[model samples]
Target chain A: MEPIKNDILDYLKDNSFMDTNIGLEDNDSLTQNGIMDSIGLLELMDYICEKYAIEVPEDMLTPENFDSLQGITNLIVKLVK
Target chain B: MSRIVCKKCVLDSDMPGIDINEESGLCHFCETYVPFSAQEKSDYLEKMEELFREYGGRGNYDVVFALSGGKDSSYTLHKLKNEYPFLKVLAVQFDNGFISDNAVENAKKMCELTGSDYFKLTMENEVLYETFRKAAESRDAFPRLAKYRASDICNTCISIIKQKLIEEAIVQDAPFIMFAFTPGQSPNPIIPLKANFIRWSRSIFEKQLQKIGVEDKDEKFLIKNEVIESMGKEGPRMLHPLCLWDYNEGQILESLVEIGWNPPDLNDSNSTNCTLNSFACQNHLEKYGIHPYAFDIAGIVRSGDMSREEGLEKLHQALSQPLIEEAAKKLNCR
Candidate 1:
């Protein structure tokens, strides 16, 4: 796994109710699969801010960027870049 | 009557007034799985933080928080105090006459630990019981079906507390009012509090009050004149920080524990506070054929904080509480 994927996994593990089988290639329907809810999404935004030192714009918390591990990883990459 | 099942899920037409597509059998609520775009959520959070900071961070003491001492409210109080230390949190508790000792303790502990000023309001049990009995007798006691399943008496208590909070805020020159409502409960974007909105809400209740033989003049006390007078002076904006942060039960528990907060074990079976909750759920289920907590618990389960089996168990326990039996008699459900 890449370093960023590891970070995502670690963050999920620290939070609650994330799948134990989460991986880079795992299914990304977090909301559909019950891995997270609306509030959970907000918490993830906070985590990203504290972890990557990225100021997540409020507009970035939609389903497009947070649907899966890959999506979140993409978001982090963009912010870090 | 023909049954209407969601083509996407098992939700049936008999569920409520929900309509399903004839071709797909999917209802609008079910069809819209993904609610927000990632960008919208991020922008909303950032905007919320900026608003809080611009309103004075901890410097401006312009609002009162309605702290129920539940998980959501506790979490909200924690964030409000942490982010805006100077904000005066007026923790108000409406003793419905049967609040659990643990709930009372939690309310007291939250105030003591935070050093926020606190107040308790209790209504006469007989009067509350009489009002609730009358409201339950009337089918339309509470016209807003989306927000609450509480008895008419419970509704009366909530109205009284809400009015009191607004009055106290205005008298104290506070500019905002806050509650712990989640997105599914109250989804309006965070904005400046308006007194006209308060008046409109009061009018809604005034109609209901008249139906139950409550005089219009009596409703005036339910909403104070001073609060109405100060509406244009920039009343407090109602904030829900819990909506701003991503929250899961585990994360909330851990964070609260770290801050010296504790959850009541009884909440595991029924509720954290409000002895009447189990009864309330029972009343809703008996009348509506579904638990009022169904939507909230389903949301949580769908979000992965709890298992479906666990949700069912909680539902069953809530239905089986002795309070339900007592409430049944009181509401003439039997």
Candidate 2:
């Protein structure tokens, strides 16, 4: 698994809402599926900061980068790069 | 009042008398939640409990409640104490520099009556008044206005109070910190926030705070490190017990009165136990074009606790006074 994908999955598990099997390509629309909300997005941002040591800029917290597991992984890759 | 549907939720504008822009079919409240959920109550509680356990509760004191001496907080404090006698309460009050004497009395009386420990933190009137003036004069004042609707001073006052309560919770090693928030004001259910989360959330408002030129460092006076460090691994959980149960305003008021919580005379135009409330409501309407009380009152009405006409009449009465010169003077607005 990609490092970003692993970190995102770890975060989801830490929050107690996701399992290890959930992956980037496996229907990752958490918001549309009701697995997350704005607050969840925020918690995700915090998790990314702690786990990946990435500081997500305020503008970067958009739906395109955070609405799904794929989006979150993409965001992590972008921020880490 | 035209019906306003939250472009996101099942909430309607008329459902809470929220002022809506007809063309957009949205209200200010809905706009703030565009990135959020319908705020399920059950999920919130479960999240809060999970946080409570994760934070570790050993050697932790009971919850620290921000008691406004109002019906909601007072009732919440009473309920928590009654249900969980093991729960110790640290009641903290923010002296807005102009609290009604009756409110002071109520705060004292209720603490004594409930046998709960209490503390009152008074902010510098000069500094508080100046912040209020600046916030009131700012264009983005509407968000602050919507929250309190009491006065410009109130936005400043609550910021201080919130900081103090968090600090106190940490200092006292309290595992949980609770407020008396109802649904419309802040839609979230119970929250377990770490010191870092609190810091991050406050950072979101840094721009707003900078607009008023209140130094970020000054936040330390309200939020102390000792408290933060003392706050165990589990950050404090902010709970609003009122949301957990179906409660009517009348039932709450009656229960409070039964417990010796007296309502200040409604005839006192300039005062109530919550002196800042009327002014908060007035300023809210002035800036936001909606009554600050509208959200709470509308919630009560929607819950069938009050009649729409009664809510409107109460709102009208609350807003009846022209902005008081004394209030502006206290706020140092010329």
Candidate 3:
């Protein structure tokens, strides 16, 4: 609850890979860094959809929107606004 | 030994942390049921249509088919080429040493018949086989399911396939990677856009080598994906058209056979694409007391695609005592 960005990143890292001891920066690229696999990516997407109640259009699931924590957080902010 | 499974579906108590409520005779996953009609679903179809429109004709190859020469992948190739003729499809296969003779032949026939571009990457799974044997020997956990879907072995194969597909797509500058996973076999809409999937795969392989008292210096083979942050960044998107469509397996099989596929053997294996699946399923069951593919079969039952009896039959086909032993013997782990 402290920072929505951190919350998102933390949840992602923790749930995925089970290798979450390492810290993730806000701008870190989760996909590029291999923090999660494809399954993990979908889980995060589903989580975002469920948590925010915003339906993510498949067209919008591009790397530009989901490649990094900052990019995803921005999308979340825009949607929940 | 008889297994206690969900009365509503196929999930068994063997899966990690799975519990069946005896009173209802349903597992928690089945009990917590909320089904949505097609109308309320997300804009998945509209987006898929848009993608098909945008990229189906835009590139030298718009999509890479993760073709295993099975009915599903073959059907996917057939549908894409015949229904959407403009899209150039690249059929990518990983020859994991044990691909069935029929599959190999049918794939060749498919290419000739369809005139589609084909590329096969061969990786001998000698080391992979060793890891599986070693895991079973050491009593280390073979990868099991958190949510029932692909059995551990199939999931491992899928991860490798996804990594290779993404790598090939990136290199070719292709816009999309296509795979044929029906409702039962798909991952949970999650994909690990492996930083360097080979690295991830190698780590697991290395563990197996260490078990066999062998060391393979195969690091030069690992591929790392480069993401140029400044460019208009787009990676390969997974397109599973089959998951969206309702298909009758028998009819699809008939269509595939007409197109040169051999009718499957009496086994009628769920994982007909890969020969290594039985070994993988055996590993999961031997170590975890659960069928690796139970979740997938159960999901199929839940979807009304297959009757509960049919799901059980598929599970029995792969996880039977004789079949499990046969797979392990082939891997030399038995």
Best model number under TM-score: 3
What digit string (tens of lDDT, one per residue) describes model 2 on residues A1-81? 267676676666544234345443544565544345334555566667777788876456555666667777877778778
* Each prediction's whole-model lDDT (CA): 0.59, 0.59, 0.63
Expressed as tens digits, the lDDT of each residue in B230-283 for candidate 3 is 113445667776765666777788888886788644243765655666666666
Docking class of 1: incorrect
Tens-digit lDDT track for model 2 on B1-334? 5555444333345432344656775554445342222265556556655655555344346778887776677777787677556566778877766665666677777788777888887767787666666766664432322343334445555666766777777666677788876554444456556555555444434444665666666563346554555554556666776665556667877888887888865443323545445555556557656544555555555544456666566655644343455567677654
Give the Cα error of residue B124 in candidate 1, in Å.
2.5
**Superior candidate under DockQ, 1 versus 3:** 3
TM-score computed on alpha carbons, candidate 2: 0.67
| lDDT score of residue B95 within candidate 2 | 72
Model 1, residue B75: displacement in angstroms? 2.1
The DockQ ranking, best first, is 3, 2, 1
Candidate 1, which segments miss by more than 4 Å at Cα?
A: A1-81, B1-13, B19-26, B57-60, B147-157, B189-191, B216-221, B257-262, B265-270, B299-318, B326-334
